[model samples]
Target chain A: MIQFRPIYVICLREFKKFFREKSRLLGTLARPVLWLFVVGNGMNSLIRPQVGFSYLQFIFPGMIGMTILFSSIFSSISIVWDREFGFMKEMLVAPISRVSIVIGKAISGTFISVAQAVIIMVLIPFLGIHLTVLQFIEVVLVSILVSFCITSLGILIAARLTSFDGFNIIMNFLVMPMLFLSGAMYPVTSLPTALRYLTHVNPLTYGIDAFKHVLLRNSAPPLGPEFPLAVDLLVVTILAFIMIILAALSFRQKE
Target chain B: MSIISVNNLTKKFKTLTAVDGVSFSVNEGEVFGFLGPNGAGKTTTINILCTLHLPTGGEASIAGYDCVKRPDEVRSSIGLIFQDTTLDTGLTAYENLKFHAYLYNLDRKLTEKRIDEMLSVVELTNRKHDLIKNFSGGMKRRLEIARGLLHYPRVLFLDEPTLGLDPQTRNTIWDFITTLRKQEKITVFMTTHYMEEAENCDRIAIMDHGKIIALDTPENLKRLVHGDTIHLVTEDNEKACAEIAKTFDILCHAENGGLFIETEKGEEFIPRLIHSLSIQVKSVNLRKPTLNDVFLKLTGRTIRDDVLSDDKEVTREFVRSHRRAQR
Candidate 1:
């Protein structure tokens, strides 16, 4: 019998490579824990919500979005490492199509990011931010979209990066700022006018808004706040597809 | 018939022309060496043959298909061991091979069988389960070899295959490569800076500054410069060089403050040269000229000093220069 070979092969290879490091697993959990247990309770004692839904409930969806965002972006760093270790050269020269290589890396990166989200999902009951049966399914769907978008961006950045260290520099520069600006840790309305405009430019903003709409009762998601849900997803998907094409084209063997 | 052929292939990056109007072909089941010092575009030529990079000018076809248009078919026929050691440290030797096998969409039963054979060839069967992070540099290199051979490619591209390994490991690796070539009847194309490695090939192409200096069997290449070589030691090298350049029509090269010359008339010319120079000769030994002499004659230098990457040789910039220096 034939097997679902390449996909399963890439997925298995990526999973072990990522989970091989224990701290990666811990880091994924630590951020969501701090937001749900420490920051949520900290904000409860600090700012009173208008609906009185408590900060623990308010930050849960944001923390999930934060986990997906950080994990997705940081996964891009593996591309830099692969280049440094010479594995990328091997991949570039493999018999498979360059498009398949891009898909393999994107699928692997998104899969890992989604898994991190799953770990946080397991802790929802302990933190008292429970998801109803319907909300649970929506969480899965949103995770997939956020995973695909961030993973695509990750591959795009990797395709352009030259040095092994520059990937970490990107994480420090763009990922942290984007995470904070996306309203992942707090409500968007509380921010200044110009900051709200900046949120419109962030992909995570749409991800979090959709997430909070389904998860947090007190937060108003304002359906497709950044752009229409279909339109924004189509834009991100198109951007991702274009990048995939570029990454494949960049694999042109040098003479 | 030629198994691989390229006609007037030229590749340029920005302002620099790394390979200019170079053309050569490898016959079926023959061992070919692309011999050149670093930055001579040896790697670039191999990359093009492996279908990793595109050629800017000219055309290269492998096994009768265009490399650029039919890359999948070309890649399927050739396995590449990059000059840089590119093994995945996170995976074990087995996993690396398995991953490559899957890349080619190998049948499960056949892949397992081939993986077993490759592990035995590299002599790493016992270490199959250990993470590649724990492998010695030589072991990692061997792992790369096995991975390249996983899909049973008809041709193997080994760029500086033994570079950076210890002599003992290098010998073992070479034996393994030679054995693989014989057993599989695979055409092996390699590039290296070492004279001996080039000599071992059935034929070699000496490349300099992105140009092919000469292409022939090692013995024939050595024959082109001289029938016999004579070594001369003298501190008055420039004067001796001038005198020899004037008196006899022969090739002379300087190395470590000594003059090596190739001429059948060494004994007859020796007395005249000594008398003309009027200097004490430290020593003189006659032997055959080598590919080193051929390279010096074509490139005019024993080394390419212009390609050194200043201070960023070990940084992420190393990768940048690895590409940028092609220009």
Candidate 2:
């Protein structure tokens, strides 16, 4: 049987460690601020959006997506660290089901990512983007769902990794490609046909689309959600379940 | 009754048979030790018994639960302190034990009581709030011991519990272990190549080449060797060696600038041999046979050969796991 106490304690350990490392909090926070101000503002004067919103406001949700993507994936690297430092064996030998470990890690990653996503929302007023109360609630809901989805995907990959030697490869090959192809920095429709197929397959694409559905509600067709709100939520929710289950399965086979 | 029983258990990697048809049983309250050099499969056998690795052949059980089939049940009933430090350095000592208690599903009240009890047992009660990174190597090990017993498991498995500690700290750790064994009623099953450390075990199984070569109490295993060992350093080493062999009819070998001989009573023999020798006897040292001598008698090698082979084995394991991660 899946034990809830193990899951709770596992998540608690991650939470305590995350807060204890002040540098880690600063590092995750600094990335999005740099992207939103330098990258977004610098590119704003060049590529003018067809819509009434400025490029800074246009990619706001994309910036939140970027924050979630990096932090969630970064959080999963704890598994590799645990393996290297011998703490993974501690949890592996525990009586709890392996599923509890995976779920605990996924939930912690979700909370940490969602927390960073909320911190990025503080930049909303400065970017001149106004949202109604209902829109803000919807945005938080989507952030939670999207964070859970991406973190589960992170856990899925981290579950199979035995060392940090593969970490750079994962960052270069997996994280970078997912960010570029997810329409996080630009519109998916503007991409070539071949790359557009990749965006449709990328789980983060739906997550960002869901973000846009709430954040950029009044925007034009191409700049708005590519698919319907229902489609985005359904895809992310389904992929979240699949990734978590697969992560737990892979974790059980960890030898 | 035997708390742990193994019947022809074996584990095979692709290129190596780490544990080969090993069988042994550990009594409920004894300190059972596996004495072996590096790469001898002591850790492999412990891993299998702890439910971390599946045995390729044979049956093993703890507390009447099969290791492979009822792993969850087996795991919950045992405590394990690995060869390397497994304590999380980022958390405080109290936090680490609390986390372990939760993982083992200890009740809230029982967790508080046990955490406090174990911390004091290891003498870390004062350092409970401090982060583990600041603690010494000995403290970390002691805390890990405390965490392992938070659930009060029946069998406490310590894989090389004192592999690289100073003599003083090792003694302190051993003291805590001995006291805790009685207080908590635990059956300790540990593995160590340190002969003196193995002397602490009520019974020891000398493992070499993935098989138990000798299994008995410390005194009994020492008796397997001939007798007391005598080391003689004389003014004329070559002549003394010849004279001792020819006159006494006892074979002696020269090693490290000293002539060594094993006899039933080295103290009595040394006085007679020193007077009979033509050359001046510089010094004579006689001591009881140690576990190292027992290992030498069995394997034709000393356990101190832990340097080159151990480094190579570690690198080989790293390369193998690196390749697996690459896939």
Candidate 3:
């Protein structure tokens, strides 16, 4: 039988480590809070109020995306750290399958990312973004799906990197473009033809679009393509699965 | 029964061959030692037996399972202590052991018992709850040994377990390992460059240039030197060497401005050499053969000579940095 105990143990250790480091927890929270209150309010005055909702309420879902993206990617950097410090050798020499290690790491990264996103979730009332109970549940579900996909992506990147500096440079290179092209800061409908195509291709675009769909379905205008809710769920679920499989394959190649 | 059987195993990395076609078998419950200088394929062989690296040729089996084909079985049957520190320093001693137990699928109740038992064995029970980052080098090594044995593996592979430790710490580490062997009856396959440490093993394979130059019990391997070695400093060293060689029909050579001879009775030869030489003997020293002598007799050089000139250390660092760019 395939044992899940190892997976659970690894995830539990990650959670313990995450909680013990107070500075890291503060850092995870600080970035999103800054973007929500300072950057959102700053940008609100410059952009025309085309969307029915205010800028702070409109960009709330984007802050959640930002939190998930940065936290998951940062958490996955531990893989490279483990390898450099020789702890990776200990985990690899264990009796369990390499796939278990990868899954364990992905799960831990997902949990941490979701936890950071929930910190933003508490700002709903403060930011004046109204949501029904059903809408709140949908928003949470989409956030989880997005977290899983992004964390899996982080694992996939981390499996191939051996140095923390290399991982940081690559994460910044990929994350900046992903966030910028994701339509998280602005509406996709207002983008030029070339930029609009880029938004369509970026997976984060679908995630943020899904978040906006669930959180502001009644209060705000649609940002981009009005795909059905089912399409967003389907795309996110498939992307998460594919990224997980890729991450597992990358780990297997190490042997 | 033999716990490990390796047949002409080989491992090559691009242009460099780290392990050549080499073979050796370790009997069950035997403390088998691979004595070699650094880069003599000791670590590579251990890595293959532990299923960490794929062999380029030949085969190896641990607990009757092929290392390459049935890696999971091989892995489950073996515990490994790497040359470098592999413990998670950020985690506490107990947490490290707990992680290993869960990975091996040990029962929850049994895992707790084993963790406590191992901590006591290594004498780290008092520090079990403390983070490993604060541990001394000796303490971390003790914890690693405890972690390695937690799963009750049939075989344990220790790669240079006491590489950089002080003499006292090295002895204590070996003491724990010896105690573990008597209590658990697990096979130990370890690699080391320290000649005196290799004496603790039941049998040792002296390796050089990726090949086993000598394999036997410590006593028998020492016997390979043939007899006690006598070092003589004479007024005429060259003449003394020729006289000893001619009269005793034994090989004698000039080393360090002195005459050296290997003979059955070093003391008996000393008197005859002084009487027969017709030259004044300044000094005579006789000593029994050691593992260092055995290495010198077989390879014509000390193990330290090879270690000093080894470029593998530089290559290892280069490889680490290179792996980063390759990704």
Candidate 4:
């Protein structure tokens, strides 16, 4: 069995690394904050809600969801840099289980990505949406799980990339497209019929829905119609497990 | 038992064998140098020893842990300075050391005390608070060395630590390395292509074509190669140099600017060499042969150029795939 030292060490190192890039920290924090502030207000002009809620109220959960999605996907870019820099070589040679390193990345990536998500999460009420303490905590836990899943997926992609150019190309081709197609920007059903499958395949879809139900819907989740809560949870959970395994397997390449 | 034992360890990339059945061992606290020309697989072997690459065949164990099966233990037992600069340019040097100290499980107070001492050792104590991005190449290299030593590993593997450094900085680094050896009992295994560098080691292994061609102390290896070396410089190009070599038993041969040959009694042989070649030599020297002569004798080739031609080379092709990694 893996012990606590590896996990603790990896996680601590990962957390420190996130703060290393001042521009990255700013970009990460500012992206979600702007979405919650200006964009949340700007969209109120064009968007009309059918439910008895303002546009800000309707868009709040999606913004929180967007924060989690972007931050989680970008977490792997640092890994790409680390690989090119040879820090990955140093990490691989450390006296720890390669599997725990992924868990540690998840810990670090999730901590920052979720921190970004929570920044937006806190700003929701300032833009006129309200939530109770229990509901807020529930949304935060879902953010943590979803962030973990997304971050591990990023690491998986990073392992195969050889250079910053390759990593940038992947970010543009894969992450950007995936984030745009997910339920973070609009309700899942609002996507064109042709794009429904895209959202269905996106783990971000269920994550967004879970937050929306707890934050905006403030009611029983529409399990069958809006989204299958159980299936989304299952997909995220499974992907997290697979990605962690793949990250461990990919780590030997550094050796 | 050997502190490090690598036997028949090999790694292949498709059809190219990077390390071919190479085997060697280092006793406790010895300054072992791995010397080779570029692309000669010195880095490949060190990577294997540090548990950074899995051998395609055979096995390597460091401090009694199997490299393939017990990589973690190998990691803990050894420290590595990679061929590429792996320092985080974003963080201050202090932060970088602290971060690594955590990975090595050094406590906060102890880590703080040691980081301070290491900074002074590298002569970067005042600069420790500055971001590594702004540091010069030599300073960066020194900081990297300090970082590698933080955990106080049993064996420290330095992969061309003085590469691209100015002579003064290289001297400083050399001094620091010797000081480290004297003060700390850490075994330092360094790789270099420079013959002068091999002379600094307690023992040296010279590799070519993925195998060690020669392994011994510099003085001992030089003893294997007899006679003094002569650098024959002439205005006339290849013809006269070729004629001179044909006229004598040239022990060492090089074709850079002129003929560099080694033979017994270089002083006595020079007059005959000039008379036979029908050329008056511009200069002649009867100097003792260095380790470079030993390498030339063993490999039957002089490493004058990095490659015969820069274009259409295997090494260039390999490095091209990682082009964006330069950033």
Candidate 5:
């Protein structure tokens, strides 16, 4: 019962708004620059290249993960806005299936997140990291998968949230934990058993690990991909599927 | 023929029943209204018919499709303007309408034509390019009406369409609604607690406590209460009530610091009562019975009493400000 036209229009509306609010694009882009230059450099001086990679190069994939994670999750905040402004009823009363709305939002969030991830790749030359054209393409593909996975999780959370009050809770409890435990800033192998279990559960762990597979191919064993590339993609794809189904089911509530 | 049919429809929210065995029908090309005070289940009934809520009992249908069994068909056959504005304030008016057209899956070639036609119907073509946040309340309402009709639905459901607008804007919206009924050949099923607004309907169903107390044409409902209503204020309302009952044999009820009585030939009766009563009469007002009087007569209390309480007024103001802050 899912219709293509509704999904297309929904995504198109999001795309139009994304460009209209120029501040949003600027704001999402600003975080990566600050992290890459300010934090990465300060950490670079403090931590030596004990594993054959500078701190700046080691956290490069983590920076991309940061960009995608923030952009994708914040994009789903539109659902809360729509509900507050009463526009969500318009879609609910329409002749389209709820699945279409969920997919439309997920697709829009993924594209926007991936766009920012690509923009982050501009730092590769500055970081003195070499990337083949195929490697760059593989990185973009992983970004898309990771973005969709995080955005779907966001949709599932937003589906039940009635206002922005829950947004702060999500930021503190969900987004921050997912980033810190995902091995984006540090290696998961060095973590103790308790936090390492959380890293395994976080989807971004597999995503950033996939990035390390391509970007850090020549790095020492401790700094390279934590799991096989196939395992990373498989986990992300499965999580994305489950999150989207749960989000759509939440929208189907008869309230 | 009837386009909307409901039979013994009921909806319960845990312990309280919001819609209790309500039944009504709306004919094609007719303006049918549900009039009642707040918490009277008018909104709950509309939500069920719009396929937004499931009825706990009985059945309802729009355009031959069951609301519960075939919600997609019911949704496709009807357009809804909710009690609150649903426009995306970030987008232009034209973009909002375009979003609606896409949601309804209108024909690609006809979409532009329909959007333009609906905009002009609401006289919003000039403001189509403006962002909705910049538009006034009345403008936002007109755009919502336009977007609702872009899909060419068989029936249009409006839940308290003119709730917060000023009198002038309310009138203008009503003009567009009536004109669209003819121009689009569409059925209108609207709910309102405004008795004055109920006059605009071809048929009005007075609801209270989740039940339809009375259903008929406005004129016929008014006819249910015989004669004009006379409001008299005197030095002693208690004495006036007794005097009027003893002398004129018409029982007068003291309400809102006045004595209200129902009698034929109110103009002549007012003068005779003033002369006959020993008490001094400060003022005497007489007017024809309105939908309010009809409701008062049927329900034993005025709808105004339920709707015009002090707490309700404060809550309404708070809600209005809250909505403004949200925008």
Candidate 6:
């Protein structure tokens, strides 16, 4: 049977590490705040009327996705750091199954990612986005799911990397494209047929779509064709599951 | 019973055979040391027994659990202190121990007690709350040792536990380990390239080129050295060398303007040589057999020479710079 104590201990340590580093905490929040105010407002005049909502409001969910995506993926960089510093040997030599380490990392990343997203969620009122308590709860639930999926993806990538430099190069290359394709900065409906097809394939697209669906429920008419909430949740859940298994498999390889 | 047993265990990484059909068993409560220079498969053997790497051939078991087949049981039974410092520098010393306790499935009260006891054993109780990043190398090593023992495994594997420490710090660490052996009766299986360090082990297996070149107690291994070495700087090397060879019936070589001889009871032979030799000897130095002598006898080279030949320039440079910085 899988033990719960190790997983709990690992998750608690990660949480402690994340909070103890004041600079890292600020860094996680800074990017999203910049995008929300500077990028969102800068483009507001040009894209607001076309999307039927203020650009800041339109991009809020995408900002949440961005926060979750960057923070979660960057958190996996710790695994590479651990390996370099010999701390990975301590964890690997432990009696607990490798799966526990992966699960613990995924859970911790999800927690931190959610925590960062909450920082964005607090600015919901300033963005003029209206949401009832139920809608807020729905957004949180979707945020947790997206965080898990992205964190698992991070773990999978990190398991195969031996150096932080390599992880940074690969993660940056992948993360920017992933964020852009996910329709976080723009509406998927306005994309050309080719880019729309790409968005359909991007898993983060579903995450942002799910968030937009819930956060914008009481706003003006739906900005895009409403992909059923059930479909979005199913896709994310499946992606998270697959990424977790892949992460575990990659971790199982001989060190 | 042997706490660790291996039957022709071999580990090959692709084309290179790291451990070439090595076999040995470490009995319970015994301090068994694996001594070798770099690239001699000492770490490979330790890794296989620790279940970190699977052997390509043969079999091994730790505390009656097969290392490959029942890795979890083996891992649970063995505590590993890696050559490199593995403590999480971001965490406090207490937090590091707590994490290990939880991993080993220790209960709340037991975990607390063990953490406290281990911290005290390593004499880090006062600094338990301090982050490891602020710790010195010796302090981090002590914390790692405390963390390793918190689980209280049946066997403790220390891979070059004192690799980079100073002589004083290394002695303190060894004191803690020897004390632990007597107090807890845990078998210690360690690897080191330091000949003096290996002298502390109950028995040692000397490895070279991925093979066991010799295995015996330090005293017994020293006995394997044919005789004591004598270096004599005489008034005339040619005459002294000829007289010593004829008089002692032992071969002597003129090296670096000195006569070198290997003879039994070199001290006794020294007086006779002085009495018989016509020319006066300037200086006579008689040295007893050391582990380096034993290694030389077996491999025709010293461990340092072998280490220098190994192409681990990065590690060599790191150790050099680290030592220089420390000085």
Q: TM-scores of the first chain across all predictions?
A: 0.86, 0.97, 0.93, 0.88, 0.97, 0.93
Candidate 5's residue-wise lDDT over A118-189, tens digit each?
Answer: 999998999978888999999999999999999999999888786788899999999999999988888888
Candidate 3 Cα lDDT to native: 0.84
List candidate 1 segments past 4 Å from native. A1-4, A218-255, B235-256, B265-278, B285-287, B303-327
Candidate 2 stretches with Cα past 4 Å from truth are B233-243, B253-258, B275-284, B308-327
Q: What TM-score does structure 4 among the candidates reach?
A: 0.89
Worst 10 residues of 1 chain A by lDDT: A218-227
Residue lDDT tens for model 2, B1-327 = 999999998877766777789999999999999998887888889988988877779999999999999998999999999988998999999999999988888899988998999889899899989999999989999999998888989999999998789999999999998898778788999999889999999999999877999999999999998989998999988889899889989888777688878899887888898889989988899989999989988987778865356664784485346434532
DockQ, in order, for the candidates? 0.53, 0.62, 0.47, 0.41, 0.54, 0.44
- Model 5 ranges off by over 4 Å: B310-327
Q: How much lDDT does candidate 5 score?
A: 0.88
Sorted into a CAPRI-style docking class, model 3 comes out as acceptable
TM-score attained by model 5: 0.95
Model 2 over residues A133-154: C-alpha lDDT tens digits?
8988888888888888888888
lDDT values, one for every candidate: 0.76, 0.87, 0.84, 0.75, 0.88, 0.85
Residue A80: error of model 4 in Å? 0.6
Worst lDDT window (10 residues) for model 4 chain B?
A: B318-327
Q: Which has the greatest DockQ?
A: 2
Ranking by lDDT: 5, 2, 6, 3, 1, 4
- Which residue pairs collide, candidate 1? A253-B52, A253-B53, A253-B54, A254-B53, B229-B287
lDDT of 1 by residue, A1-255 (tens): 123466677777889888788898788789889778777788778976545466776667778888987888777667777777778777666666556666777788887888888788887777666678988888888888888787777777777776765766887888887888877776676678998888777778777776766776444443114344566566556656765667656643244
Question: Which candidate, 4 or 6, has the higher lDDT?
Answer: 6
- What is the per-residue lDDT of model 4 for residues B1-327, given as tens digits with 9 covering 90 to 100? 468888988877556677889889988888999887777788878777876666789888888888888877788888888767888887789978887887778877899999999998888999888988899998988998998999889999999888888889888889999998998888889998777777899889888778888888888888887878888777774767567657664533556676777678878887787778766567766768787777777876655455464532576365334323321
**Residue B155, model 4, lDDT:** 91
Better candidate by lDDT, 5 or 6 = 5
**Of the true interface contacts, what fraction does each candidate have?**
0.76, 0.76, 0.63, 0.51, 0.78, 0.73
Residues A106-170, model 3: lDDT tens digits? 88988888888877788888887677889877877787898889888988889888676686577
